[model samples]
Structures are given as C-alpha cells and as structure tokens.
Target chain A: MSSFEVPEVSNKQVIFKNYVVGKVNDSDLEIRTSQLRLELPEDGTNDVLVKNLYLSPDPYMRSRMKEDYTSYVPPFTPGKPIDGYGVSKVVLSKNPAFKEGDYVTSFTRWEEYSVIPGGNGLKVIDTSESVPLSYYVGCLGMPGFTAYVGLYEILKPKQGETIYVSAASGAVGQLVGQLAKLAGLYVVGSAGSQQKIDLLKEKLGYDVAFNYKQETDYNAALKKYCPKGIDMYFENVGGKMLEAVLDNMNKFGRIAVCGLISQYEKENSDGIHNLSRLISARITMRGFLQADHANLQPEFLQKMLGYLKEKKFVYIEDIDEGLESAVGAFVKLLSGGNVGKQILKVATD
Target chain B: MSSFEVPEVSNKQVIFKNYVVGKVNDSDLEIRTSQLRLELPEDGTNDVLVKNLYLSPDPYMRSRMKEDYTSYVPPFTPGKPIDGYGVSKVVLSKNPAFKEGDYVTSFTRWEEYSVIPGGNGLKVIDTSESVPLSYYVGCLGMPGFTAYVGLYEILKPKQGETIYVSAASGAVGQLVGQLAKLAGLYVVGSAGSQQKIDLLKEKLGYDVAFNYKQETDYNAALKKYCPKGIDMYFENVGGKMLEAVLDNMNKFGRIAVCGLISQYEKENSDGIHNLSRLISARITMRGFLQADHANLQPEFLQKMLGYLKEKKFVYIEDIDEGLESAVGAFVKLLSGGNVGKQILKVATD
Candidate 1:
C-alpha cells in the first residue's frame, strides 16, 4: 500500500453527453476520470470531500431531458456528472456537523469521489446496524423514504382499504406494497412482466399482481383484480394506467403520484379525460419529493429496520458494478428492465 | 284559483321519463301534480313535504347516467325525478328539527313538490336578508360550498399564488376564482366564449381570462398565461385541457380536481398521459365531493352572504322560466351554453 502513488488522486464521473429522444442508450453517457484531485481544497469553507460507495439509478431520470421539463429542478447538466441519490463517506469536512470519516446519504453525482457543500442538503448517516451499508442506497435510503412518505403521509392508508401500486417490483413500489399490507390493507400491484408480477405477489406478498404489459386493457385488469374498486393507488407508471385507475378508484380514494415511467419517454402525450372521476370518486392525489420528508428519516428507518429484522420486508437490487455501466442500467431501469432498485456500486466493500 | 277544483292535495311530483343522453330534450320530464288528500305527517319519521321553488342544474348530473359511474354515486333511477340541491319551502314537516314553513335545503327532485325522509340529508336554510332567496340555489348554495371546499379545503390556497379555474363564469368556477382572489392569489380562468371570458375578468374579477374554445392549443395557451408557471390549478375541464395544465404546473403545485365536463360526452375518451408531471414536479393533485364538505356550509353561507350583502361578491344566474323550460336549459348548461348557475323557476314567486 505504501508503494502506491494513490493514482494521482483523480476523480471518475459519469456524464450525460446529450439528451436523447426515445429510449436512452448506453452511448448517451461517458465515464471519464478527471485529472483533478478527488480531495477537497484545504481552504474550501463549506465543501466536504466524499468517497462515493453506492448510487441509486431511479426511473425519473428519463423525464429530466425533455425541453418541457424546464420548470422542474433543472435537468442534469448535459456535460456535467449525472447526479442522484448515493451513499458516501466523508474523507474531509469543513461543515460543522460532518467530520472526516463520517458517512452520509444525499444527492451526489455518479462518481467515485465528490465535493458536497454545507447547509441543509447533507445529513450524517447513523450506523448502529445489523444491516448491510448498501441498503442505505436502496431500502434504508431514498427508495425507502419514497415508499414511507407515499403511504403514511400521502395515501394515509387506513385499515382494510384496497391499495394498488404500479411498478410493484421497483424499489419504492415494493416497499409501499409491503407497508400497505402491514397496515391491514388488501394490496394489488402491476408490473411490466409476469416474472415481476409474480415477484410482487410471491415475494412481496401483494394480494394480487398483474403483468400490465400483457394486460391489453388496463382498466379491465384493474376491474378484475380490484373487484370492490381501489381505495388507494400508488402511481408509478402513468398514462393509460392512471386513466384506468381513475375509472376504478372508490369514493374518497387517495392516490400518491410517485413516478410515471411510461410517459416520460414519449415526446407528446395523450390527453387525460377521466379527470371527472376525481369529482365523482372524490380522490385525493398528491405528488411528493423524498427530500421534503427528511424529518421522517428517523421514524422511517426505525420502522423499516424493524421490518427488515422481522423479515417482513424484502428488497431486490439490480447492480451495475462500474460507473461506465450506470447509464445503461439507468436507461434500462426507466424502460422497466430492472426488477427492483437499479444500483451502481461505485466502490466495493 | 276558484275555477280550479283544488282537491285535498297530498303530494305532486315531476318524474323523469328515461335516462336522456347528449342534450336533454323536453320529453325527458313530465310534471304530475296530484293531491294525496292526507294531513301533515308527523316529525322524526323522516318524511317532509316541501313546496320546492328552485332547483339547480349541475354538470355532475351528466355523469349520473353512465353505467360506469357506479364508483361514485348510484345512477339516478329513470322513473324518479333527477334530484340535486334545491331551496324549498317546507309546507309540512316530518323531520324533527325542520318545522312547517321553514326554508330547507336538500337533495330535492326537480318537482313542484317533494317529500324528503330524514335519513341524514337535510339542512334548514336561514335566509340571509343581505342576499336574495334565489342565491340559496346559487352563490349561497352548492356552488359556494363547492368553491369553499375545493379552494380552502382541497387547494389550501396560499397568498399570492397563481390559481387557474376553468368554467370561470359558471356556478362553481366563478366563486372559486373570486375566493382565490380574495385570498390574495393571482387568479386566471378559462371560459367557453369571449363573453364568458369578459365576465371572468370584468365581472368576476379574474386576473386573466381565456376562452378555451378559441385557443387551438391548450398547452400553448397555458404557457402564455402562466409563463412563470401556475402554483394551483382548479381543474374542471378534462381531456386536452388537463394534459396542457399538466405541462405548465409548477413543482409542488396543487391541482384541485373539481369537474371534467369536456370528456362527459365523448364515447371514446383520451387518456391522461402527462400525469407523469406529478413525479417530476412533486405536485399534489386531489379531488373532492361537495357532499363531504356539507359540514362547512353554515360557515360558508355566513361568509358568502356577508360578501354578497357587502357587494364583495356578485353571482350571475341563467334562469329558465317554468318547469317546461328546465330540461332545455339544463341541457344547454351541460353544453357550456349557460354563463352561470342554471336554475329552473318551478313556481311563480
């Protein structure tokens, strides 16, 4: 170890070359290791040097490139390192709460090293665990928070209500289904393939699961599975699916609009006509960002960990071993190619 | 009055012929005035016969006929008169709280007379001197309640927020826009015609107004009006309008799903595809029924009456003379022909 030059301390990052129209290809991103040092400058006031370990590749990235997406949090800069949720270790810190060797979870570029700023964006990850650290990038992290907030805060799951989640095998959807089930809800979910559908019912314990791709009529499928009608819909893949759900939702039904992977790829989308269902059924649909639910991390982690220990919750991860593979994995995840949380292992244990 | 052999009348009704579609024709209803020759019934028995004077023509009635609308409320039975919120004079009381001659509001049929049984659905209307008796069927009635519930209860209006209400000069929309303006919001509205648009800005006091039919592209119109992005969308028209609104919604914006008149007549409707915006924008979209907000009526009426008396609020009504004209006027109302509350003057004042 002493004989090594530390590779000149350069940084490796995944960058989006340009915005693609339809399905994103692997060639869209380039993994270039910079000649710049990975460590933060000694005089940098608020920045902290982070050694990235795990990175989450969510489906929402697909919608970021569209010219229509201007009003949202600015899209990933075309030539800059693509940023997302990740787990990292602080190698150096100028921020008061974070010190050298501290672990934190936040939005970080898909790179082996990064310099993050101080203030409200960063939080120290408490590790008194009987769990794997990578779980922080999946179940104990953003995806988990997505599920927790959707169920407790948005959906407001009541006992015995019929809950339906789309993309049931995805990281957030899987956790949401399980949480609804724990609350004594009759849960149903839809995934792209039969394999994913089976995973939802068999592994995730969803009361009913359907392959939405194979189901020619999404509304008919919803009617078949949700005989009494849906009390809540945890939306993931929007478009025809939402139209169908709107038609089938019961009175006072609550919908947590989480993700809509289906329409993100399309340049022009179709009009939504079933909105009258909102008036008739009196549904409450809300969209949320996980960052807003940071205050609930303690409660979410405590409950999720308890479920993990009792074997009540199961999480599956699709791993990409290198930064170069992150783009392909992310693209595939957007197209519903991955079974669960699409993860990139930037630095292995 | 002496020429007519007014037998000891018991009850009279206007029964519907059948479920009419498209535009309601005159043949749809028949007024059957009869005398049962029975004395006034007892109280606490749920039976109350009120001589109904005013009946509201709401757009939601169009949805009540569809076989698919069972998810909300049961369809109006064909033989029974179509019922909605009405201001009536209680001639005989069977419900304990409501006495004879009391002006009560209930889901009364479109008839000269109605017998309502107290199964938890009647409210005594204490007429406010500041407003007209007809207002109970308009501003101080269901429309006001709908606006109050949708804006304050569902939308949670914040100061200076931009709110866009469709059907701007219509019953619910007019009140909602005015209330939003009163709440310090920058309110815009979309109406059916230039006249309606004029009424929105000049009469209803909407900050900006557009005639949706004249705008070839809803999305473009939304962009033009809400350049900085809309903080809240009071959704009424669905189909293309909803799709367009989705594109212009700001992150964390709230959309109160009030109604969807655009798609009610279409056989095969367009599906909502832009719902994916919910994920990227972290928007909160919810729907509510006025029936659920019944509890707020007392307070709503109090405030609304004060506004009307003080001239802070002005409501317009498109009245059709006699029961004979009701069906046509209601049909016109459904076609977006009427500018405001479409009321049927069942009896002479």
Candidate 2:
C-alpha cells in the first residue's frame, strides 16, 4: 500500500477505563472499536502510520496503571489507549527514515492501528529469516538489553563467581542467568513453580534451580542452593526474596535491582528485615532503567544476534492472540500466571 | 628513655570478660593490673612500645565484642586486653620511624602501656602546636577519614545538592555535615536528643537538625527537614531512619551506608518497608569501609588540616577520665548517653 492509499477500517483498541488499586482484574480494561482511515495526514511529514503486530505485557505496566505513582516512566492516562513496547508493520510513512512494508519497533498503543510520531524511541527492525519478529518486543528487545546492562555493567561478573537470580524464568531473569553462565560463573535461579524451575535448569542451563513456592524458608532455600555464598544477585522479585538473598550474599557482593514484581500490586509493600546485612557484607545495590541505556543497543543487538544464531541463548514466550486477550494476559502477568515473556499478538502479518 | 632501658611497671588494663548479646553492659569488661617491662623485645626490629594517652569509644567496637563476627577488623579476644584506635606517646622504639617522646597513633589496647608492631596502620602525629593530641583519636583519626571517603569517594557530592545524615552530632556525622556544607550543599541531620540537635544546628552549621525521639512519624520528620527531597543520605543509624530516608529520596539519589548502629544491638532487626523506591527513583546504595580508601588519605589530611587550622571545622568531645570509666562510657555510647565523640582519657600528655 502507498502512503496515499486510504481504507476505512475498524480499529480495535484496549482502553484504560480507570486507575487501578491492589490486584488488577480484566474488568479494568475494555476493548472498543473505532473507525480509522488508514492514510497519512496531508501535513504528516514526520509521522508513520503502523499496523500493530505484537504488544508486550510487562510488570512495569502495573506501575503505569496506578492513578498517582512516581517512576522512571509516566503513568497511563485514564480513558486513553494503553501504550507500550510493540512490534508493528508500517503501512503508510511520510517519514524519510521509514518506508512502506518496513517492520519497526516503537512505543505504540494497544490498538490494531497506531499513528506514531517520528523522532526518538523508534527503531526499524532487521527482518532476518532466522529469528521470529515477535522476539523484537522480547528476547531481542527491552528485556534483553536490560539483562545485558545489569549483568555486564552493574554486576561486573567475574569468572567462577556465584550468581543468584529471583524470578529466574521470567524474560529478563532467564537471560541474566544464561549470560552469567556464558561468562563462566556458577548460576542459581528461583521461580514460583516446579515447572518453571525445571525449565530454568533443563532449558536455561542454570546450575541449580529451585521452586520458591515449595520452600518453607526462603533463607534456607538460598543457603542450600548457593552454598559458597552469592556474589551477585539479579533482583527481579523484591520483598522477602531480597531479604533472603541479602542473608546469603558474600562479602563485597553486588545486587542489580531490575524489578520488584512482588510488591507492584500490593497497596502496602512488605518490609525487608535483612537490609542491615548489606552493611555487614559490604554490598552494592543499584537500580536502573533500560531506557537510560539506549547507547548500548547496537552492541547489545550484535552480541544477542550472535548468541541467537549460534543457539547459545534460549527464549520462551506465552503469546496470547487478539487485542481482547491483552487485558487478561496483563493481569495474569502480575499474578505470575503466565510463564516466560507474556506477549499479545494484535494482528497477523 | 632509651630503647634498651627496662622499667618494671604495674600496668592497669581493661580486659574483655566474654561475648556480649544485645546492649553491652558495664559488667562485660573488667579491669586488671599486670606487670610490664618497658623495653623492646629481643631481636625485635619493628616493635614500638608506647604509653597510651586517649582511647576512642566507637560504635564499631560493639561488633568487635561479638564472639565470631566477620568484618574488616577482627573481633577482640575474650580474656585479653581490648584494642581500639588511640593516641599514644612513644616510650621505646626499635623501628627507625619512631623515637622516644614522639607521639603516634595506632590500634592500641585499653591500657597504660602497649607494644605495637610498627609497619602498617601506624602514623606518627605531626605534633602541630595548633591541634590538640586528643583530636587524633576523634576528628583526625578513623572517624574523620571515614566521613571523607564516604562523601567524596562514594556519594560523590556536588554543589547545591541536599544531604541528610543520621546521628548527625557524633564524631563522623558532625564532620560529614560540615564538610558537605563547605562543599556548598544544603545539609540536614537527625539525632536522638534535643541537645545533640542543638549542637548540630548551632555549632556544626547544619541547615536543619531534628531530634528523632520527639517525632511521632519518621517519614513526616524527613519531609519537614528535607523539603526538597534528599539527594544524598549518609546512613548511620539504620532500620526506621533508613526506611524514612528512602521514602523521601529524589530521583537518581545516592545512599552511602556508613554504619547501622541501631541494628547492631538488636537480635532481630527492624524491617525497612520502602526499599522499592530504589527502583522508581533509580537510586544507588553502597556499603563501604574506610580501610579500602587509604590512597585518598594524603589529600584528605591536607584539606582536613587546613580546615582545622582555619577554624572551619568544629569538633566536640565528651572526655571520660581513666580506664575505670571506659566500660561505662562504652555502654553509654551504645545507648546515645554520651554527647559528641566519647573518649576515655587514659592519661594526660
């Protein structure tokens, strides 16, 4: 289709009905159909009209659902389309950088069609035959870059060092464990279910994987898994996991605080009692956002692409079909109902 | 006295009775008299025998009283003389670095006389007419160097930033406030009593100081003092104070974990409920030891000596007389009973 070709189509969008509190339910989001003329505006010089293909359901989206919250990213506006990282196919482009039939990744709304303003935060995806296009929003995208920066930059992993990762089968945690193992470190991981633990050990190549749900004592579990003591901790689920990891950390250990998924849905967060151990063990804990690390994308893509081609990295996605399933998929993500990266397939290419 | 001269003297020493639990009491230590020959050992080329002048009663010493604690410094042996940072007058020296009548500072025991091995951790006092000898055990000693490294090296304070310090009127806190102020930053400090709060505001030049004992809610107290939100927090008394500080920290804030005096005496530590703020605010919290930054001492000394000479830095000391008062002073230090830096005046130079 040319930039001037217009078509009257029904655009289905997932709208944010109201601000959420406590646990999110599917009723919080409502799908509405609106008619959109699929064509560029007359003065659209730097805009790209894209057809959304896949939408990502991330834990960070939970923070954005709150009415009033302070975070690295802004909260979603009520009554507006929920926007997040998505893989889209450009149908009409007035921007010189993007052409018709080019697959691009950008922050797009949870709608079948989206008009994204050109500038920053837009990347044209390389359509390679080896990898799936949906992976752009997951393993090869934000989560992958997060794991790279956290392990290499923040943790500064050394060979033979021991690493412990919480929520170990999640998108970022899976990559963190694999990257640490590739760096010649002993890696241990914890997940919510036995199936996830099995996947972490069998598929992800983790040295040891434990189901946190089965362990009566989190501290004892950490001690059993990381016998020599944890040198680096990839903190995904905070609260008790953070406290337990602190107790098992070695002297001069480092903790990369990527996400606190456990406390995201709670009105009042659980208290971490073992924080004083950070002092006794002389630990360094730092929190970071992947958006701040855009400069490393090229390097991250090159290495990740190589690992993917060589079959050295493994990724799994629990993809839900259609925009109607997005709301349910997101709620399931916060409740740990979905395994691996939870993605919404909006439209088929 | 010559290095070969021997004198039979009855040396009164304070000995550690046993391992302590919870708060330290006066009964945990006992005074004993032992005969000592004030002469260098046979073929001892690097030994220096000295007469103890002043001994510092620090919070870190509380951890040393535990039976099998792991730290940068080892625990004090039970049924032996307790060792700590002290100022001493050299009585005999086999090392060329020291001679009789020269004042030196080292990790000396709580006794009238001590024989210290000479090479490392010992620095000869400049014997400047401007500063008092007792200052070596407080401001110009371990605590002083600790503040310098934490603020300049770790926190990396910039001008016009806001800083909050807990236990603000003590040895390290008072100096940290003054140094931060000199660096052109707004500083706030919190102490346990009104007297210490007044000392911080009136004498130490803190922009704001609060008595945490009077505050019904710690988070509200932090908001009142640090209205701009804390840019850097010098953590000393941890537990509740740390939780409150974390709640009020600005985006990209830094926390330098110096000591957790509140948790040191507790069998089970209080939980910190606001650690999740580290992720939203992109905070970096690191625990450090002063021994790791020996290379920065030369620059620290030059600047600190200048500040002392120019009357830009003010230090206060609660001097307790004799080794008999040492036990009471140490117990008092743990309970915040003594003001400023608590020190035992073993003997007057």
Candidate 3:
C-alpha cells in the first residue's frame, strides 16, 4: 500500500450551470477547477479514487439537464459536476476489489478526478483487449448494450426481414444497423446529413441510407427504401419520423423505442398521427432501459468483443480534446454536429 | 332427414351502398329483399344455409366501410350485405356436421338467411346454458373472447393494480372492466356519456368512471381517479384518450390496444403528443386480433359462462328491433349512441 507516493492535482470539472429549457446550448454548463488528493480519505475505506480518461457525451445527457422531467435516470443538479459514463484509471483505492492502475468504467463525473464508491456501478474493464480505452465510454459501454437489447431482445430481428433505424449514424443506431445486417436483415438507416448517410451505408454496411433532412416526405422516403414494409423499426429520433415509420410498418411489426431525441428539446412534442396503424398491423412497441437488462451485460460484452476482433462491427468516436470542451461537444451532439459516439477526452493513458 | 319441410322465403338484406369516407350514415346502406330457396342445391355439398337471428354491430365495422383499409378481416364491398358476428339457426345443411335446427354462430351477413361455406368459422353454441341466444352475438361470443385475450393473455392484470379502460360501456370495454374487477384490480373507465358512465360504475363494477366528453382535462380526471398511476390500460377509443393515458401511466405499465374507435371515422387521426412518456415509463403497448388468440377461446367461454351463471359478471345489450334498423344501429354505434353491445335482431328463432 505504501509502494508509491500520491500526488495532489487541480481537478477540472464540467459543471451544470442551471436547468436547461428548450434547446440545450454550451452556456448551460460551465467549467470549474478544484483541488483533489490522489489518495483516499481516512473514512473512505470502500471508495476508489479514479482519474477520468474519457467521458461520454450522450443525447440522454440533454434530458438530465432539465429539472422536472420524469425519466429512468435522475436529473443533474446545478452548481455541481455533471455525471456520466466515463472510462478511468484507479489511481488510488482503499477498496479491496480495486487497486491502483486498474482500468474501469462507471457513471463518474465529467471531471478529471472522481472518488467512486466501490461495488456500486463501477465495472473493471479488460485492458488485455487492444481496443482503445475510450471504447468503454462508447461502443463497449451503455450505447453498445442499448443497441444489442433493442435489436436482439426487443425487435428480435429475423433473417431477410426489413429493419429501419432512425438517427442511424449515431452511437446506438449505427450498431443497430450493423447487428441487423449480421442477422441477415434488409437494413435501412435515416440520418440528418449526407456524411452520416454515407457513413451508415459505406462504413456501417447498411443496405440503404437516407438523409432525412433532404426528404420532404418521410413516408415517401421510407416507402422508397422499405418496399416490403418495415418489419422492425429501431426508433431513436421520434415525432414525425415515428409517424412515418408507423405508416410503413408491416403486419406484426415491432418498434423498439430507444430514444426520442427529436422530442426532448421541444416544449411541445410533434404529435404522432398514424398510431392507429399499430392496431391494424398488430404491432408491438416497447420502451426499455439498458440498466434493466444488466443480466445480459456479460454476454453482450463477450459477443461485442468477438465482433470487434473479427472486424464484423466497426465503431466510430467523435472526441473533443479535454474536459473544458465537454459542453461544446454535448451541444454539438444535440444539434447533430458530430457523428457516431461523441466523447470528451479528459486525460491520456 | 327432417320431419319439417323447407320453404322458400324473401331474404331481407341490409346492403352496403358504397364505401363510407368519414362518418357513416343511413344513406350508406339500403334494405333490399331478395328471393332465396330454403333448400340447399345438390352441388352445394359443403354449405349450410342458416337463418340469421341476431347480428352484432361493432365499432370495427366502421373500419370495413373504408375503401382501402387493411385489417385482420377484409373490407365490406359496396352493394353487398355487410358481415359481422351473428347467431343463426341452421335451416338447411348439405354438410353433415351441422344438422337442421342446430344453433350456430359465424361471421354472417345482415340478412334473414345466409348460405355460409361449411367448416369455415362456424361455431355451434351450447343452447343448454339457458343464456339468451343473442348473448352468443355479444357477451358470450367474439367480444367476450377479445376481452379475455386482452385482459388475461396480453395485460395479465395483477391483483390490486390499477386499470383504465376507454369506451367503457361498449362490448369489449365492459367485459375488460369486469374481468379486471374480478382480478381484484382498482378499475377506472372512460366513456362518452353520463349513461355509459353510470353503466360503468353502478352496473359494470368499475371503481371509478368518467364521461370523457365532460372532462376538460383527461389527465387530471385520470389522476384524480387513479391516484395510484394506471398499471394497465385496455385501449378501445384511441387518439386523445390514449395520449392522456400515456401521461398517467406508471412505470412498466402495459397497454392492450383492443380497438381505436375514435380514429376509425376521422380522415386524419388526432395525433398523440405524450408518446415520449412511453420511454420514460417503460410502457409496453401491444395491438392484437382475436383470431390470433383462438386457442384461448374455449377457456374464455368456460370462465365467462361460469361468471354469468353465478351473476358475477353482468351483460348488457342495446338491441335494435329488426334488420331494417341495421344502418341506423351501425351509425348510432359509431357515434356512441348505443349503451352496450349494439345488436340488430334480424329474425326471431
């Protein structure tokens, strides 16, 4: 325990300035610097002091910035460091399960240093894998598992069946398209830009990709792509897209409601018109949380690692330089400025 | 094979004049009398000529009036007698399985006589039960099975859980509330009129009932009734009611979409705005057809009959006098004028 000396450093944090209303901007959060000791306090016998290397900037983080919204996760407090999924190195640990130099992933703060309580949500990652440590905050993390659950467990993709994914170039959507492809499905993805559409088609191996911003009629676009009708829809951007998807869904179709990023920012939601199609088609639409499916995490991680090794799954990350850039990165993410999983590189390995 | 001789009769039929665009009216159908031989033709070896007694006018019939709407059942053609759940007496049969004077229920037309193809959807009722023959067309038939499948198979209500049923005094809604009450659930129902509300609370055993038309804010009304959030929603009238229910739903709530009567007549559906709540609450919304759950029919019948015999479950019917009243009955049923399962008595047994 006394092998090395612990150093005190200035901890940089991305703080939530206030509860955001309507569209989230960089001004919603502020950067603050504070002092932190590398060693645990005398009473912190079950805590691990970690230096955050990479922090995930997710669309769901925008949801947490609001004060009174009811969701699976609680809202972030103002004047405090915002918390999210981050990959970190255990610099000093009083917990028996964790030691110094152990690489782990947890719901840590958007800060350079964090003292995470042991055996709560902290998961030690396998450093033996040649994948980047930041992968734990993106592909090997919550977003990856969300896609797996939505595809295999919710929609249950069948071979030769058609699948349509909204926001398909994003973290979950990209993986969902790839997984549907691996299951021998006719996969089509919709994104906001030409670059994301290209990434979805060329890089992600989607059968068809469309820039939704360019399509005047979403229903016409979906009909053009899914000629046979959509058997499964991985719904990310809801509202008008969901309405169009409902119109193009086949009999006994399934919609896995992963996210509604399109509706999150708006004070009044863009209402869905064709929900009656759900009855005529006998569709099943279910919403789920990744935390609820923790039992499948080991299997998810194993299969994802294997897919990565075989080059069957390709991952992309849009990384900002430091914790100071988190607010800008998150604001950009919400506006669809970045493709794939957006991450803020807090520190180097 | 029979002592009584068959006689030729005038088949009085309610003919669908043309496909209805919006709300159906009496002008959309016409009563026509056609001559028919009571005896089956020698070549009609697999057909049974039945004298229709009672015909059920359901909300789903509105969907069939559309020129090109896809459903589990085919659309009713113009100039043809509309088909529905009917109780009939087999008057002439070339098929050996069904004999003359045998009572059967099938998808029969709004006519005095129908020559249904044998062994195709015909189910002979047990007349020994001492229940009314018209019950086979309403409470003890297709509507009953629909409620059973939705409550037992789909929602699977837990004791003490809260349930909200829309279109409360109608065919399936009445049964769903009764079933939920039988399961010890705190049941609340929403109907369009005061009479239906009274029927729900006083007659149908719903713990609370509201006239949805009278309520300015449905969410507030639901919140007042179901202080504990809705655990299961038996959806009958969709559109605004569904949107309100979504807002008042508890986490892990289940919604069994039986029918969307509110949206059937509208050209453009009233869009649901609060669907994003489905994700936050982790709701499971499913749409089902009674045909898909044929295996549960026998069990449903046994339990329903038992409940009826014990006076544990009450049945209601808004019976119209003759086949001449068919168009009026159907029109009224769509507008929520009928209190219970609307039945058109085509003939007396």
Taking every candidate in turn, the Cα RMSD to the unseen true structure, in Å, is: 4.3, 3.4, 3.1
Worst 10 residues of 2 chain B by lDDT: B1-10
Cα DockQ of the candidate 1 complex = 0.57
Q: Each model's C-alpha lDDT?
A: 0.80, 0.89, 0.89
Please report how far candidate 3 places residue A32 from its true position, in Å.
3.0
Candidate 1 per-residue C-alpha lDDT over B279-333 given as tens digits, one digit per residue, 9 for 90 to 100? 6677888877777877887798778877876788788889887766777877798
* lDDT per residue as tens, model 3, B48-114: 9899999999888888888887877889999999998899999878888888899998888889999
Q: For residues A1-349, what per-residue lDDT tens digits would candidate 2 score against the true structure?
A: 5645667789999999989889898899999999999776667558888999999988999989887788867899889999999999988888889888999888999999999976246689888645898899888989889999999988999999999998888989899989999999999999999889889999998999998889959999988999999999999988888888888899999999999999988898888876767777889999988877789988999999999999998998899999989889998899888889888998898
Off by over 4 Å in 1: A1-13, A31-51, A89-106, A113-130, A193-198, A213-217, A306-312, B1-50, B71-73, B79-81, B90-106, B113-131, B215-228
Clashing pairs in 1: A272-B272, B9-B35, B10-B35, B10-B36, B46-B117, B46-B118
Per-residue alpha-carbon lDDT of model 3 for A18-52, expressed as tens digits?
A: 99889987788899999886776667558888889
Give the interface-residue alpha carbon RMSD of model 2: 1.3
After superposition, the stretches of candidate 2 with alpha carbons farther than 4 Å from their true spots are A1-7, A37-47, A94-96, A117-120, A128-130, B1-8, B32-48, B92-98, B117-121, B128-130
Off by over 4 Å in 3: A1-8, A37-40, A117-119, B1-8, B117-119
Residue pairs in collision within model 3: none
Best by the TM-score measure:
3
